[model samples]
Target chain A: MSTTEPKRRGRRPNGADTKEALLTAAREVFAEQGYDAATVRAIASSAGVDPAMVNHWFGGKEGLFTAAVQIPINPAEIVREVLEGPREQIGERIIRRFVTVWDGVGGGQFAALIRSVAGNEQAVTMLREFVQNVLFNRLVKVLGVDHPEMRVALCGSQLIGLGMARYVVRIDPLASADADAVAATIGPNLQHYLTGDLQLLA
Target chain B: MSTTEPKRRGRRPNGADTKEALLTAAREVFAEQGYDAATVRAIASSAGVDPAMVNHWFGGKEGLFTAAVQIPINPAEIVREVLEGPREQIGERIIRRFVTVWDGVGGGQFAALIRSVAGNEQAVTMLREFVQNVLFNRLVKVLGVDHPEMRVALCGSQLIGLGMARYVVRIDPLASADADAVAATIGPNLQHYLTGDLQLLA
Candidate 1:
């Protein structure tokens, strides 16, 4: 019984350790070589693990990236919260939510992501996926607006720009302004992107 | 008399050559070490000119940078164009102007500026000053809106964000979308930031 118990414990811990090693290796590889240049084999080799382990654990490079740079907040939950609110105030609520999460909880991860984005194609891809696939796609679907992609892109640009100014570039007034104040000033524009007329070409 | 004239010509050409040398050296240094890490002395030495020449021609490193990365388009001219139109269409015109400048004429310089901004504080400072002092302050004054700074900042965020996505990050749809389409979609939001009612707190 004792021997069996030890073996069971060893199996689980080994899996956890391999996952951790892959994550650490992946971050270093991504930082050094960037997203496009980083390969699964290299990440695995750096971790001293078999290349297949990456697929087994992360499914692929994109999944591995998502795990590596995961924000603390869940996109689905934010989508639900924004969608649950009064439809008219959805824009205000969404901007306020972004300011809160990005300022406090997700600030560090976001900064790291934004910093990596300048010269790194992978970082840019990761950012695009998170904004497009994770956040805006779901929101746009819920809104059922015309030219949903364009609408989402516009909203994404504004929010990402707000993040860039406030955090990355540290533009003044905008950077130091109170969160609610920013939301109030910027929220209407977001709302316009969401439910307002986009006037996209056919 | 011939000897005296030759010496005079020699002195003027030397001065112009030194100034030109400093400008070339400054661009290389700024690109390699970024704006903050680069020094006037280093730029001068790289150019094989006396360090004081940097101050003589450019006034300082900041002036040198302004000269190096100067955007071809005049912000004041764009502001005039946007404001001179029918008040209702101001947003559309402004966004159209931004898309045109960034996509074509000023694309390369803007890309360099935005790319450097990630790790370079000096680039950020330059961008902030250009947006605040040169562009938005004048536009806000023309509009005479309340919370003028905030309004300008908001406008700056959106425009900067569009530039980042389309040029730097290269996000699709927004990146590839026609300028007129983008302007139509994003224009109203700018209009809102400019002349629309902003629900700012007291």
Candidate 2:
């Protein structure tokens, strides 16, 4: 060690350094043991920091995962943008927004999430939570529809399906089709899921 | 070698025996080397039979894969059943049939196919061909709709997405929902994709 450098022992590292350390540790632990088996205490210990640091920096495990996974876009902003339009066009707006965002980021995060979901319990949980909490719940509340849970799930199925075919699976025509074309084709389906009759039992 | 059985080297094996051997060898080779790298010659050698046997039995690599994978149900039959019903209710029938088939098989084949699709090129190709040829093409031909390709793709996305969510990823509610409930919820969306306006070129 350089003599000029400050002593590291017993001194609290800067917040940025601690946070980075925690993220690195979390990624490693999650990869190794998966989400269910990974513990906050273990992650903190691996980072050479106190367990409380995790709660302090991120509210809890879900918050920590949100940080570590780093889903490229803020879902809240997307939701807000979609809701700004006429309620009838909400489905079209949502589909367009989805295509634009995924295409904008080159679908790296979504691809990674989908690929990891098959074998990883943590990934599956993260996906379910993200869809239910971030995307579906908010829309369901805005729509104020009956069977909100089923509405959200149906919507999720369509959007997630679009993502899978166009991005992950790279199915032809859909994969290469322009965003407008895709939106136009898929928008109505999303509309039906969002506000149309699901034919569910009341 | 069984003492009662004649020496096996020079004789061309029986058709059933040779076909079975080729299928077993093809499965191992495909799993180990993936579809792109697994050659017919390699499979034949592994089966201890002449390379010509693959062509004689299954036509080629694609046919061999179809035999090995064995997707539990026939696509043609499902298409026929869906088509036999009234044109307006085709979507509901299709969704019901889909839920019934996947639920009947216990989702093993669907889960396996979805999971394998990510890393395996051969699996992706096979999936594309299966969807495009067996499912989509037949449906499009029956519907004789405008933008048949897009229609097929949109339908594929929803079904594939539902499978991923319910079986592969096991998202709650949708995953646990009975076949009837799932069909009721997702049926209309599928119907829309099948015969409803897609808003293409607008």
Best candidate, TM-score-wise?
1
lDDT for model 2, on a 0 to 1 scale? Answer: 0.77
Error of 2 at A47 (Å): 16
Clashing pairs in 2: none
Off by over 4 Å in 1: A1-65, A106-108, B1-56, B59-61, B106-108
lDDT per residue as tens, model 2, A1-202 = 3326534565565977998999878766755554555799999999999999999888887677667665455677877888996888888888888888778767745665565665456677777787888777987797798778777777778888898888877777898888888877888788877888877744
C-alpha DockQ for predicted model 2: 0.48
Per-residue lDDT of candidate 1, residues A39-66 (tens digit): 9999999999999989988998878878
lDDT per residue for candidate 2 within B1-202, as digits (tens), equals: 5667554554555877888899878767765554656799999999999999888788888788777765455888888888996787787787777778888767755665565565456677778777777777898897888878878788889988898878866766788888778877887778778888777875
Task: Supply candidate 1's per-residue lDDT for B183.
Answer: 82
Colliding residue pairs in candidate 1: none
**lDDT per residue (tens digit) for residues B2-28 in model 1:** 223324544577898997788778767
CA-lDDT, candidates in order: 0.78, 0.77
Report the TM-score of candidate 2, chain B only.
0.72
Residue B168 of model 1: what lDDT?
66
Prediction 2 TM-score vs. true: 0.74
Interface RMSD of 1: 1.5
